[model samples]
Structure formats: C-alpha cells, structure tokens
Target: MDNASLKKRDLAVLWHPCSQMKDYERYPMTPIKRGEGVYLEDFDGNRYIDAVSSWWVNLFGHSNPIIANAMKEQVDKLEHVIFAGFTHEPAIDLAEQLVAMTPEGLDRVFYGENGSSAVEIALKMSLHYWQLAGKPEKTQFIALESGYHGETTGALAVSDLGLYKAPYKPLMFDVMTAPSPDCFYREEGESWHDYSLRQFEKMRELVEREHKKVAAIIVEPLVQCASGMRMYHPVYLSELRKLCDEFDVHLIADEIAVGFGRTGTLFACEQADISPDFMCVSKGLTAGFLPLSAMLTRESIFQAFYDDYEKLTAFLHSHSYTGYATGCAVAKATLDIFQSQPVIENNKVLAQHMAQATAHFADHPNIAEVRQTGMILAAEMVQDKKSRTPYNWKERRGMRVYEHALSQGALLRPLGNIVYFMPPYVITPEEIDKLADIAWQGIQLATKD
Candidate 1:
C-alpha cells in the first residue's frame, strides 16, 4: 500500500501514544514498511536513517542477524512457558549472566515485561521491603525535579515531568521532589561540578529531614533522557550515594534508557563507583528484539521477604511474560555481543566524532546549548542565547526540525525545543556525518522566522 493509504487506514483505527490526534491533520504519521541496519524504509521505497534508535532501544541495528537468529532458534524449541511454576533454560542462563555482569552486590533479579513495569516493581519492592522490616511508615518516594521514569501508576507518581504527569495529578500519589542537578542551567562562570554540589545540598537537606518516611531516592544517574536529556556531573551521583548510605535509605537507579552502552560506560553508575539498591534495566536488554525488563537488587533486599508462605513474607509480583524464553534468548545475545566485541571502546570513537560534528551548532544564533553524553547529542533551541531563554513550547520549534529531517530522509525526533541524536551502535561514521548535517540544516529551518 502507498503511504497515504496506509496512513489513512491507521488514522481511522489507531490512536498513537504521546501525541494529540487532531495534530495528525497537519503532521501525519510515516508508515514504515521495513528496517535494516540503521535505516527504515517506507512502502513507497523512501528511506530514513533510524535515529533515536527507535525510541532508544535498537542497539546493534535494525533486524540484527545475531539477535534475530537467536530468537528464531528459541521459538523452535520453546516460545514461552508459565514462569510462575515452570522454569526455562534461557531465563536461567540470562539471569546468571546479568548477575555476573552488572555491578557488584546486585545478585538477584526480578523480571517485568516493560520499562514502566520494571519501575513499578522497584517502587513496590522498596516499599514492601521497608514495610516488612518494621518501618511501615517509610512509604514515600523522592524523585528529582524534571525527572521522567515511566508512565505506570506508581512510576508516574514519582515522575516530575509536567508534560506527562500534570494532567493526571489528581490520580497519582503524592511524591517529594528534589531539585535536579542538571548542569544546563549552570551560571555563566560556574563549573558543572560546583553547580552540581550546590544542587546536592537541597537533596541532602530533604533526606536528612525525611529519611524516616522516604522509602527510596530514585535517580537516572548521569543523564536524564526523557527530560530532554538533561545531564549532570558524576560527582552528584557519588555524593547522593553517600547521602543515601548515611540516611539509611535505598537508592534506586533507573537505567532503562541509558544502560547497555548508551552512555560512555557499560552502566552510568560505574562512573560514580556506586551500586544502587535497585537497578532497573530494559530497552536495550533484548537489543529491541523483544519486550523485557529486569529489576536487579542486592541480596540484602532480596532476603527481606525470605520466610515461609505461612508467615506471608513472600514478595508477590509476577507478569504473564516474566522471564520469557525468546526475550531472554535475545537478551543473552545482546550481552554476548557486548562481551565478545569492544562496543564501549568503539562508542568512544563515535562519540568523539559526534561531538566534533555538532560543534558548529555552538555558533548558531538560536542554539542555547550543544551538549552530549556518549552516543547521545542534543541541541537546545532558544529565544535568547545570552540568557538561555527557551523558545515558547506552543511555537512547536522542535516539530519544524522533525518535519525538515523527515523531508531530508532522516528521523530526528525532538523533545520540546531540543533536537537530539541517539543512533544505534552499528551506525557508521559516515552515517553520523549525515545525521549531523541533516540536524544542522533542520535546526536552521526550525529556528528561522
């Protein structure tokens, strides 16, 4: 079918997420037919580079043969089984590998089907652990201002982003928010470390006063992807870990978007030399081949509810597809690729190329900041560069960039007025250059009056 026909049919039956349906009158959806090696093709033979990694999931590339073949073999043997009572080899092997590979002390794993569910599991587990340990009053969660975790009820409650959580405010549980250590708002002469330290003071005060009722203080580590990729110095995480230890609180690291080599290291927490009580991982866990999420916690937390059924100490949580065989097989293949190949080392070189390519944006009049975190690069559009005054959201400046990029055979999705590039690990330097060029041109068109 042609693009128009497919889009028409889709509009009639489908309501897309994270979008207003009425906007489709002006900005229609692109009907993708196939994807291969960082590029997606339409039914009419048009191709666009799969930037943003299809919502920051695809790692090796689209239709990666290694992961695809692993899934194919697993489906032939056992597609899935009831994970509650029955066991599977793929799940067992994947769990073992994850425990061995993740940071020290996170030896136990709990499976969920998506990032949001993984977050919910972490929240519930933390609350339950506190409750079982005779601290039933420790029921509140503390999240960073401008942080975005996931959209489930419990996850959404802790998230502070207004775009997603504002309308549903009445439905969510109250949460305490700490001032974020985002370095984007640092003053003219202030160093990132200095600014981060100053911001850490606010959280320190909150934890000191509210540690008794706070279950856990959740953070996104070095980069907060969903809130326009807001980044902070690693020193902030180091200090936060110390505070959590001192306050006797659990620290939950939500690495769903930044894990699996998206950041400079294998995991962002490694940069701070800290291990959180609960580490939620997904997205790239299966290399985008299947749905999977794992909440890794220390054995101490796992031992909280280790009693018999009569005592009612068992932590009850299960999803229908928890530890799914095919998902586990693909996740194992993803881990294997990381183990066998120098993915982190190669990413360092590509990250440098991306930095150099985007350096020109610093001179653009409407550009406020050109920031990067490993493979992720973002250009923030502004109304005044001197004061870093952001453009009005209703202006839809980022949407213009998206449209321009689509017209140029590139997919450059934006967050508010920020256009970001987060391509697959398999993307070549040549492809990086193309993406950078398109982004630069698209920004110009977007900012032009």
Candidate 2:
C-alpha cells in the first residue's frame, strides 16, 4: 500500500496511546520500518535519530543483537505460561540478577508488563504490607508535584501534572502532594545543596505531620522526566531518607525512567547513599528489548505478606503477562550486556560533554534553563528567561520544535516547553554532538515566533 493508504488505514484501525485521536488527521503517523542503534528508519526509507530512545525505553539502543537473540531463543522454548503456578529459568535468573544489580535491600522482585503496572504493584504492596502489619489506617500516599509515574488509575492519582489527571479527578485517590526540588529557576545564587534542603524540608514536614496515615512517600529520584525534565541534587535524597526513617514511612523510589545507569549510576538511589523500601524499575530493565517492569522491595516488606494464607493478607497482585518468558530472557541477556560492555562508563563521558555544550543555551534570552543529570539533558524555553516564565501551552511551541526536528532528520520531541534528550546508552561522543546540534537548531527554528 502507498503512504496515503497506510495513513488512512492507521486512522481507521489503530488507536495510539496517550493521544487525542483527532490530531491524527493533522499529523499522520510515520510508520517506522526498522531500528538500529540510536536510529529509526521509516517505511519511506527516511532515517531519524531516535533522540528520546522511543519514549525513554531504548537504553542499549533499538534492535540490539544480544537482546534480540535472547528473545528469539526464549520464544522458541516457552512463549508464556501461567505465572501464578509455573515459573521459568529466565524468570528466576532475571530476578536474581535484578536483586543483585538493584539498590541495597531490594532483595525481592514482583514482575509486571509495563512501568505503570510495576508502580501499581509497588503501591499495592506498600498498602498491603501496612495493612497486614495491623496498621490498615496507613493507606495514604504522598507524591511530589509535577511527578509523572504512569497512566493507570493508581499511578495517575500520584502524578501531579493536572493536564493528564485533571479530568479524572473523580477517579483519583487521595494523595498528599509536595513541591518538587526545582533547582534550575530557584532564587538567585541558591546552591544545589541548599535548594535540595529546602525541597527536602517540605517533604519532611509533610511526612512528619501525615506519617500516621501515610503508607509511603514516592519520588522520582534525581530527575523527574515527565514534568519538564526537572532535576534535583542527590543530597535531597539523603535527607529525605532520614525523615522517612524518623516518621516510619516507606520511601518508594520510582526509578522506572531513570534506572539502569541513566544517572551515571546503576540505580539513581546509589548517588544519594540511600536505599528505598521499594523501587519501581522498568524502562531500561530489559535494555528496551521487551516489555518488562519490576517492583523490588526489602525482606521486611516481604515478611509482612508472609502470613497464613487464610488471612488473605498476602500481597496478592498479579498481571496476566507477569514474568513473561521472553521478556525475562531478554532482560537477563540485557544485564549481561551491561557487565561485558562499558555502557555506563561510556555514558559518563557523553554526559559530561552534553552538560558542557548545553551550557551555551543557558543564557539565551528565549532559553529558561538547562538541566543535566547523568546523560539525560533538557533545555527549557521561556518567553521571559530572566523571569523564568515559560510560553503558554496553547502556543504548542514545544510540539512545533518536535515536528521541526523530525523534518530535520532528528527525533527530538519536546516535553511541553522543554526540549530534552534521553538517547540510548550506545550513542557515541560524535553522535552526542549531532544530537546537540540538531537540538540547538530546533531551538532556533522553534523560537521564530
């Protein structure tokens, strides 16, 4: 079929995720035929650099041979099984490896098919643990402002972006929200350490006052990707952990987007010198080879659910595709790739260069801020840089830059007014320069208004 026919067919048959269907008419979908490391090829043979790593999933790069082979081999053996009773070797190996590689104290892993479901498991586990321990009143959860966990009901309840959750206000659960550690546009001369302290102090007060009713406090450690690539210092995490301990609140680190060496560490919590009571990790878990997410918790949390079966106090949550054989095998192989390859170390050099180059836009009048945490970088555009006032959402300024970059052979989709890059770990120093160049040009082209 021709491109027009394909586009028409897509509009008729396919429903894209997190999108308004009407916009499909204006911006027809570009059908990607295949992907290689850091690049995607459309059906028309047009190549676009995958700067966002396909919504922050493709960490080791798209179509990596090792992960592909693992999935292929596993599919031939056992495609899937009833995870409730039967388990596979790939599942066992992946869980063991994840426990080893994850943050300290995260000994057990509960699997899910996506990040949202993984977060759902963490939330449910936290509530159930408290309930079984005779503190059923501790059902409330605290989340940060502008935090983006996932799209599911429980995940949406904690997320603060009103645009996504506003309409569903009736369906959302009660969640005490705290202000984010917004370091970029802080009061003049505010140090990162000091700024982190202020944000942590707010969280501490919230936990202290609400700890009796609160089950856990969730955070997107180091970097909050969905809400405009907001980042804070590791010191904030150190202080928050102490407060959680003092108030006896479980610290749930939502590292789904930033885990697997995104922030210069295997897990983002490593930089903070703190271990979460439970950690939700997914995006880079399988190096983007397959859909897999895991919510890991400490032995203490696991014990709470280890009571008699008659009580039904067990954390009895299950997903149909829980521990899917192919995903598990691919995840295991992906971990192997991390060990044998210097992916994390390579990102260290690229992150440094990215931070340096992005600094050039810091003072640009239309540029509000530049945030760099590990290899994840974001450039915030503003109508008034000195005032840190972003352009209105109605302007579609970010979406324009997104489309413009696509036309320029780069896939630099903007998150609202923030243009960010979460390129795969396999991207090289030279590719980093190209990413920066294309992003800068998108900035220049986008600000003509």
Best by lDDT: 1
TM-score of each: 0.99, 0.97
> Which prediction has the highest TM-score against the true structure?
1
TM-score of 2: 0.97
Every model's Cα RMSD, please? 0.8, 1.3
The residue-level lDDT of candidate 2 at 190 comes to: 91
Q: Residue-wise lDDT of candidate 1 within 64-156, one digit each (tens)?
A: 999999999999999999988899999999999999988899999998999999999999999999989999999999999999899988899
**What's the lDDT for all of these models?**
0.93, 0.87
Name the Cα RMSD for model 1: 0.8
Residue-level lDDT tens digits of model 2 in 221-331: 999898888999999999989988988889999999999888899889999989999899898888877789988999988887787889786667888899888899988
For model 1, the local distance difference test gives 0.93
